[model samples]
Target chain A: MCLKSVEGIVLVVGDNVDTDAIVPGRYLTLTDTRELGKHALEGLDPSIPGKLKERNLIVAGRNFGCGSSREHAVLALLGAGVKAVVAESFARIFYRNAINRGLLVVEAPGVSQKVSDGDRLVIDLESGVVVLASGETLPFKPIAREVLEIIEAGGLIERLRKELQYGRG
Target chain B: MVNVAMDSLTAKILARASGRDRVEVGETVVATVDKVMIHDVTGPITLDLIDNLNARIPKPESLYIFLDHYSPSPSIPASGIHRRFRIFARTNGVINFFDVGEGVCHQVMVEGIVKPGEVVVGADSHTTTYGALAAFSTGIGSSEAAYAILTGRLWFKVPEPLYVRLDGALPSYASGKDIILSVLGILGQEGANYKALEFAGPGLRTLSMSDRLTVANMSVECGAKNAIFPLDEVTLDYVREFNTPIDLSSLSYLRTAKVESPHLTLDLSTLEPMVAKPHSPANVAPVPSVEGVSIDAAFIGSCTNGRYEDLLAAARILKGRRVSKDVRLIVTPASKRVLMRALQDGLIKMLLDAGAVVTPPSCGACFGGHLGVVGDDEVIISSSNRNFVGRMGSPKAKIYLASPVTVAASALEGCVTDPRRYLG
Candidate 1:
């Protein structure tokens, strides 16, 4: 099931946020992910990881996640406690990984300018609404009903488990 | 509003299309895997996962593994990965594994493996490069890649294919790299997000297989799932040279898969040498349009521009000259086979004699992981794809993406300049 949490807002960047930017090639050997998280966005803003520790929502422009299909990008974001990513568009691979891992990624093409850094955001996945502390409400198209169900059921693996259990029991 | 019929190739690739008209912004789709490709960098990991999952290797003949990235490198870990991949393929009875020195995976697969109407998936993003052959291919992660290797199937939401039409013959100095960058300038980085870019028009026929591959390889730069050019006789001739034994009598299968698109044309006769300025891949302009831009490093290679044709082009320019003293030029062949062929033709000696260092075939400077690191405030005009900030090295350094001719010319001048001046 999706969790509704209000984490602080973290504005990293927009437009071609490549995998190399999220987790540089040097850190590829370290599989622990926590260490990889430290370098997330170090290519752009060196202070992102520490700032991310206190933030929840990441706002960005078009093509929020592009480049390599490394899942480490998603893991690093989730590990840093980002509750949702609001972008105008996302790379296909990144979009899929976020859902499979139960990370909330909302599509708000207008969200980039509506919110700024240090702003508080309240995301309600169930309602597909993102509300800024300034009381600005950004309505995003929710994931397909069935996809939401899979995510609500705890991602693909858990959904598969439930399906198997239901079949046998 | 407009009626368009899906072509036979598209129909074959989209047989599993759920008939949904439009994929919403945040929806997840389980797309059919058209083609699955792997290379040395991540194939070993995928092979291990396939063993653990105990999944049947579906269509071993269709699955491809190419050893590119770390060919001839003394890196023990890289060699270990290659060895394990070979053992896995041999033990599993998988048929399509191109060993080191074969060629870059994208080029090898396009030249020998891919066909029209196929949906290809690779562990590398440039897999989209195959779209040039009128096939649909995209990159996937190692885990999801492992799943595909095991099950021979993966899910994808059918992406709405963007229609880009180029109609006129390209000028001699301008090449496919310029066409793609020009397209990127119009589409922007995110303009084609999650969409397949289908390139068609009379002008496409004028471009060679290598040229089309260069265009398709960088489609990912604009956030496209893939960029496709309908397969034709040019593609067949190129593939036949490599895979002589394959019964291509069934080539007619491609015709039946053709998707009908309205004619859209781009006249390239007046196009000039173009460059994608640093910090972003889509930021583009004519090379001569930006004058006096000095370069510290110049690289010529990658799956995109590391083909034999690209090397020959550079060799022609470097034959009787030397790279500028302030500039260090690095030439990497996309594959060991390319290296050997270049050596046989004395392209290697020509490049070295011209003051360029020839390195083994690998991702190398393109990914900024190793080799050809640039210093702060330095700028490089490279034949490889993508010029994003720090793509080749230090974030402080800058990269400009250009054609091999431009890179060669810039290497001689030590600044971004037109290649045509040196040609005459």
Candidate 2:
């Protein structure tokens, strides 16, 4: 079943927030999502993880997740209860990693400018629009259908399992 | 009316992989992958996913596994993971498993495995390095890698190619590292986001294969999906040396394909040594401008710039010279092959004589994983790519990215010095 929507309070961050900032390299050995969550954004600001407890949405500027192909960054966010990341843009690998891991990453330009920390956001995966607390709606480019299928299946591993069982993957 | 379809090498490669005559930009295609790679860091995750999904790889020979990162088991946990990898490889009958000290996956792949016009995916972003060999390569996440390994295929959105035309040979003071850093400076941190950087023009004749590899290795640093050089004598010469058999007729597309227009035309002769200042690969500047900035450490190695050519360049600068008393110099070869070649060439001896600590071939301290991790408030000048915050250790520590020659010069001066001063 496809996820229709996600609504949550957001934590805002600035531009060029890299993967090293999302999950430091030291804790990469900890692959468990929950364990990785404890250190989300540790390099950027230690207090960010504390804020994530209350806000499960992230509003960010351009080039979020800009370094390394470590899936730990996406796992860290998932572990921290981050339901979706609405950024102006994302580094390509991080964008792919997020989708492959079933993380909702919408690239809605200017979404970062209108949204502030703690503001509530409603992301409708179907319409590819983000509904903000101020009632302003921002439309993001719809993700590719192939990518959506992966996300709908709750990640690549799950999707692959189903595909293999069906012998049509 | 022109009937011929003018496609960049990126499009042609993707088209071929997808079993189509041509593919459009932004179109997603389920393409067969010619090669797949995973490192110690991402390898374990892939294995775990494979186990959970109960999937068996149909063709294990296409998969390459390397124990490069946290290599030789940096800790008990790392060793345990490495042990699991060995067992998994043996049980699965995968023959291309590279043991610890073999070298980085990217280095080893290009040494003899990856071929032009092939689609390669690796769990590490530097997999873009294979593009130097005329292959279409990009990095993927662990889960994606697992899926690719099981199916021998993955989907790729054909990226728009950004043509970079080079016009002249690089000045003696500059290397491919400088060329890439300068390009990154022009194209900022995200300038080429999701775009393919295609290299061509007469200047392509000037760069050695090692130089091309260094330039392509850091494509991801500027948000490029992949960076490719055309198949020329330089690439052919290198591949021939390794005895990689290939069908030359099929590779004509690489040499003949052209983009509509060049996005950036660079005169390599005008270039000089460059550095990416503290914290960002795109935060680049000429080496002369950043000269005199003190450094606590200087390192020359990693998949980015740790080849035999890079080592020899550094050795030339360090010969008959002692490293500054205040600066600790660390040299890690990219692979065991590179290490062996360097040792035979006496580059290792020159570095050791210059008071540098030579670590075994591994992705040591490049990602701050194990050896050579910098401390708080420390400043390091490295030849490896990516100087992101805390990348080489403490978040408080700063990293300056440069070529190996610049690294050697800086180690001797205990500061960021112009490599040109010693190059001639």
Candidate 3:
């Protein structure tokens, strides 16, 4: 289902938070989702995954999820209970993977600059707004229509399943 | 003036793949993939999703499953994936199931099967490597690959094209690794985001098939969706050498092919041996600039630099010299085919005589799987693409990306050193 808004504390990170750093190659063989989550971002900080509580969000710099076309990186983040990722921009493959998996990835050009680590923010996917505790709001491009439909269907797996059931997309 | 009407080679390839006269940038098209590949790392997960779809693939002949990464069965997981992939391929009638040690997915494609004017996609991002053959190839995630497996098609947003023209012949000491690292340096890591890098120019003749593949393989480092070289006599001869009894002379697209406008030219001859310092591929510099930087290990393999010529380059430097006692050297041929050829040519014996460990035909140590994993406090010089943190071993270990020549040279000295003196 498409979440109209997400309210959570942000775990801020720098630019080019690539896939290998998100989920390093050594542990890539462990295809289990929960195990991958426990080791997520171990390259950057081994403790990051444990810090991610339910509905927590990640606010990162430009080109988040850069490098590697592996969906394991996205799965790791989602498996750790990350509600959404708001970055200046995203690597194309990661963006598509996130959308297909029904994960919320927002591109807010100055989102990182506006929020510090531990800042509670309310992000509206439908309207593309990020509201900080101080009442400051950042505008972003709203989720695309077709992508919203995928999110509404609980991801591409469900969407594809529906298509197969009905005999069309 | 903006050439809004200029369609890229990527566009043309898409147009042909989709059965249309033309496809433009930003248009979504259902591209018919000429071939697709999935390795051990991602293939099992893709299989799970494919099982969900429960769609019997019609053209099983076009799909290729490679068991390269962690091959030789590093652990039970890798072995299980291998077994599953074997069963899946056999049951589905897929002919190109490359078993353990066959080679990397990219090298396997280059050895044969991949052709010009084709659209290829693989689960691995380095799938862009096949574009060296003038095919429009890009990397996609396993979800997309799963969809492609169910059907013979996948949708793509025809990316904007970035033309990178090479000028002047590179010095013999400088290999394709230097050329590509220099390109990555100039374009940072994300300069070509969501774009296709089309390589076309007179200087293209200076590179070998492996060299073109080397440059094309790392196109994803700059965030390009695809990278391609136009079909010429060099590529034609290379392709024909493997796919015998097929007439390449009858192909029309090879003769009239050309990339569109909006491009930049790079002078190849001026480039020196280069390296990308940790923890990203874009942080590139000349070898001399980073000279004397110590290393704990030297790796000479990956889809980017594990061809016969790459091993030959390293063999030239280590013919009689022993690797530094403090340094460990690991060489992995891109494929079992390359390893066998190198063995017949005595490259493997020479490396072993010099105290280097030669692993099986697999993607090892490049992404820190096994064989020569660096320590937390160590530094490494590798011919593999990508030097991201924790890419090789510990996140604390630094990786320096270089050509096989530099890797061999540095392996002997245990530090980053100029390769000119080692070159013949």
lDDT of 3 by residue, B98-194 (tens): 8988998899898878888888889998999988888888888888787777677888888988888888997899888888888899898888989
lDDT of 1: 0.74
Model 2 interface root-mean-square deviation: 0.9
DockQ of 3: 0.74
Q: How would you encode candidate 1's per-residue C-alpha lDDT over B356-398 as one tens digit per residue?
A: 9998777777777566867789899898886766667787888
The model with the greatest DockQ is 2
Q: Write the per-residue lDDT of candidate 2 for residues A1-169, one digit (tens) a residue.
A: 4688899999999999999899988887788899999999989998999889999999999999998999999999999999999999999999988988888899999998899888989998778799999998999977877877777787878888888999873
Question: C-alpha displacement of B105 in model 2, angstroms?
Answer: 1.3
Q: How would you order the candidates by lDDT, starting with the best?
A: 2, 3, 1
lDDT for B314 in candidate 1 is: 93
Q: Which candidate is the best by TM-score?
A: 2
**Candidate that beats the other on DockQ, 1 or 3, i.e. the better one:** 3
Residue B102 CA displacement from its true place in model 2, Å? 0.7
Error of 1 at B358 (Å): 0.9
Residue lDDT tens for model 2, B1-424: 5323478788889999999888888999889998899988877778879998877789999889999888777898888888888999999988999999998788889898999889999999898999998899999999889989999999999999888998888787778998899899999999999999988887878898988999999888899999998888888999899999999998988886463368898899899889999878999998988999999999899999999999999999999999999999999898888999999988889899999999998898889987799999999999999898899899999999999999999999999999888976
lDDT of each: 0.74, 0.90, 0.85
Which of 2 and 3 is the better model by DockQ?
Answer: 2
